[model samples]
Target: MQLTILRSQLLSGLEKVGRAVNSRSTLPVLAHVFLEACDNRLSFFATDLETGIVMPVSAEVKTPGRTTVPAGPFTEYAKTLPTQAELTLTLKDGKLTVKSGASKASFATGDPGDYPPRPTLAEADHTFTLLPGVLKDLLRQTLPVTATDEARAILTGVQFDAAPAQLTLRAADGFRACVAQAGYESLPLAPFQAVVTARSLREVLRLLDGTHPEAVQIIADQQARVAFLLAEGVIVFAQTLAGEYPDVDQVVPKTATTEAVLSVEAFIRACKQMRVAADKPREALGRLDLQNSGANAVKVTAEGEILTASETTLTGDVTVTGQSMQIALNLAFVLDMLEVIKTSHVRLKANAPNTPVVLTPEGVPGLLYVIMPMVGH
Candidate 1:
């Protein structure tokens, strides 16, 4: 393969597909980036068995061919070159040569035959489209709640449910669950469900930033492979986990014995301050002492093990209803939800001390977050 491309473009394409490169794979080629120079365009491909990514860029192709080279060292070398310099890549006798200005580097090429080929999604199956911003929001909110336990592989992925009128995303890690949905105009196919790994979801988000595609086209085949198509032929594909995702709706509390609305900024600040104290405990759970201070006010007290290193803030506009309560919860989890909530204020609903607390933004529709309370000694 012989090609002349801008250093910046090459770096961008390399970074895009590098997410799927398995640097420690038993097969050496899996850690390398596959380059195909053809049709005045250069394409990069990488896969780690479960997930794969393809990215293409405009280039001046001198000779149309293909080659595979280690991604790590080549990417690092490209980063050190001038961004606007023209980078020339040539393959001869299984050795890849890189030249720009006065600097030159050579890397041993891997056998291109060993690189896994890209999987294609049937065009007929690629009918569903979702707004990039909306999809990005859904992933940001739900991915954090996915379980990391490999034994329950299903919980490690974000579940996508496409109904007749609305599309929903749900995730649960046993301790907490998140459900987010948005209404759609039409259905490309019948209602269906699939689970995509959280890692793949993050990669899709990254690709959306670079491509900023109009809408993400989703395709799920009978073989359980899922693919997201972006602009410029950029695609993120992965194998769906085999199993049923837990019913998250049942875990959300329908009724609340206590409810409070607090300023999102203030609540997050209090949680962070308390988290500093909570970090001392073995369990790493933060303690929240909520009590009705007055009509439209709730005193939030954050205490540590000594209880003397406590901070109290009387949150205003706090419309507390029903009974007052104190709950222990994972501060990190609460902070995660707070970071993603798109609202000036957030509503918290709690039924009992041990039950999960439901959180929802004041104006955001079709988004629900539930966190199971922590047990106190």
Candidate 2:
């Protein structure tokens, strides 16, 4: 293979596909990137079985050929060269040479045929389109809540529900669940739901965040492989688990008695301060005391006496407490929800001490977080 490419273009292509290269893979070929030069363009491809990415960049192609080289060493080496330098690459006798200005390096090459074939999605059977921003937002909100434990294999993947006009993404790690809903103009009528690995979802988000494409085309087949196509690249992901996700809708409470609308910032700050004290407890529980001070003023007190060696107090007077319940909850979980809420105020509802505590954005009801409470001694 022989190609001359601008350093910036080569680096951009390398970084995009490098995300899928596993540095510590049992199969050595998985650690290498496939470099193919053709038609005045260079394409970089990498796959770790579960996820694959392909990035195409403009290059001056002198000869059409393909080869595989260690991704980590090549990427690190390219980064040190001047950004505007022109990189010349050639492959001969199982060796690859890289020359830029006064610096030159050669690395052993692996047989390109040994690299795994990039999975392709059939364009005819099932397809859908989504605004890149909408899909990116859904991932940002739900991916963090996905279960990482391999024991509950099903919970490791985010559930994608595509209906007629609305798309919803749901993820849970048993203690907390996050559901994000958005509207789409049109969607394909296929399996109403599919479970994709959290790793796949994260990779897609990482790629989209860097490239920021206007829209993305998604293809899913009966084989459970999902592919995302954008302007500059494509990502194909393999589903890790296959099963019916638990009925999250049933877990969301239908009714509540005590709801308090408090400033999100204040609640978050209180939770942060209380975290220091809560950390001292074996279970990391933060106690919240809510009471009706007057017709319109509700007092919120979050105290963590164990960690502080003293009591940590956060008092806030809010307009109302919908249903009053003194609930003990995990401080870290509460703080995570508070940080992500987009509204100025957060509404907290609880039916009982053991029941789930529901948090909703002040004006938005669709996005809801259900956090299970901690048992107090």
Estimate the overall C-alpha local distance difference test score of candidate 1. Answer: 0.85
TM-score, cand. 1 vs. native = 0.94
Highest TM-score against the true fold, candidate: 1
lDDT of 2 by residue, 1-377 (tens): 89999999989988888889997989999999999999999988998888888888999999999999999999999999998899999888988899998999999999999999867665435677889888877787788778878989889988888776677888898998888888763576563678888987888888887886778877777677777787676564655468879888788998887777778877777666656665453345666766655454433334454543433333454645555457788877777677766789888888888888888888865688888888663
Residue clash pairs of candidate 2: 257-322, 257-323, 258-322, 258-323, 258-324, 259-322, 259-323, 277-307
Candidate 1 displacement at residue 152 in angstroms:
2.0
- Write one digit per residue (lDDT tens) for candidate 1, span 1-377: 89999998899899999999999988888889999999999999999988889999999999999989999999999999987899999999999999998999999998877788878765435357788888889999999899888989999999999887889999999999999998653465777788999888889988888787877888887767789888888989878898877889998889999998888988887777766666453234666656665555655445565654766564565677788787888878888899997899989999888899999999999998999998653
What RMSD value applies to candidate 2?
2.5
lDDT of each structure?
A: 0.85, 0.78
Clashes of each: 0, 8
Model 2, which residues run further than 4 Å from truth?
189-191, 234-240, 280-283, 293-317
